[model samples]
Target: MAVLFSVIPLLLIALAVYGAVVVLRRSRQVSSAWSSGITAQARCVRSYTTTNRSGDSMVRTTLHHVYEFTTRDGRVIRFDETDGPSTRIEGDIVTVHYLPVRPELATAKVPAPGKLAASTGCALLFLTVFIAFAIFLIVVANSDSMR
Candidate 1:
């Protein structure tokens, strides 16, 4: 039972760290794309929504859009994005930025510095909270063992 408690908190900490890493990496990628990427006009080919039911009455809907753009070299690329602008429907044109060498990593808009900082702060905060919680759990487990 004690081991189970320790394991659970450790797992949570690990997950938190993983989440932080993912967030940081994505931020770096987006930053890089914004700095050294090519701009193109992408046409929305399809707009769709996916509904997920969690329980008897709980439902979650996610919006997805498929866009196709032609690169400068005449190659066409199509990609799907989630939670894009709601006003964007099929046949609408939107601006996208992507690395020439990595066209697959396209983004609809440049990430603002403020938003990037906020996201990084949030991820670090999440990691810090989880680490503290895990340490607290270990302390409690050790105290119980002394009793």
Candidate 2:
């Protein structure tokens, strides 16, 4: 049980580190993509499906495809890598920053930096709380066995 407690914390820290690294990589990539003129992004979409798991029904989403948005410059853009979840949505007129050479590889601009920061903070807080709870569970289990 004590081992579980310690392992939980290590896992949380590892996730936090991973998130930081991702953010850093994104920051660098976005900077290089920002050009002097307008860069367009495709209309992103997700296919919804209804499914039941363990008696609880829920809507599940999967990547359908991406539609390239045409700017005045007549350039088609899409994602260079499809591994990451999309940050855009249909009918969303998001500001896109793309590499001049590879317009397909682009990132949608966040409308509000402060709001995004707040959301990121909340996500981190939730992760921390979950980790704490896991640790508490292990501690209680171990102490019970000790008695």
Task: Please report the candidate that would top TM-score against the real structure.
Answer: 1
RMSD in angstroms, all models? 2.3, 6.2
Query: What TM-score should be assigned to candidate 2?
Result: 0.50
Best by lDDT, which number? 1
User: Tens digit of lDDT per residue, candidate 1, span 28-125?
Assistant: 76777777747899999999999999989999999999989998899999988787778889999888888898877787764677887897888788
The regions of model 1 sitting more than 4 angstroms off are: 51-60
Q: Tens-digit lDDT track for model 2 on 64-123?
A: 334456655776555533323354455545456676665665766533446556756676
Give candidate 2 regions above 4 Å deviation. 1-55, 60-77, 80-94, 99-105
Provide TM-scores for the models.
0.84, 0.50
For every model in order, what is the number of clashing pairs? 0, 0
Model 2 worst lDDT window (10 residues):
46-55
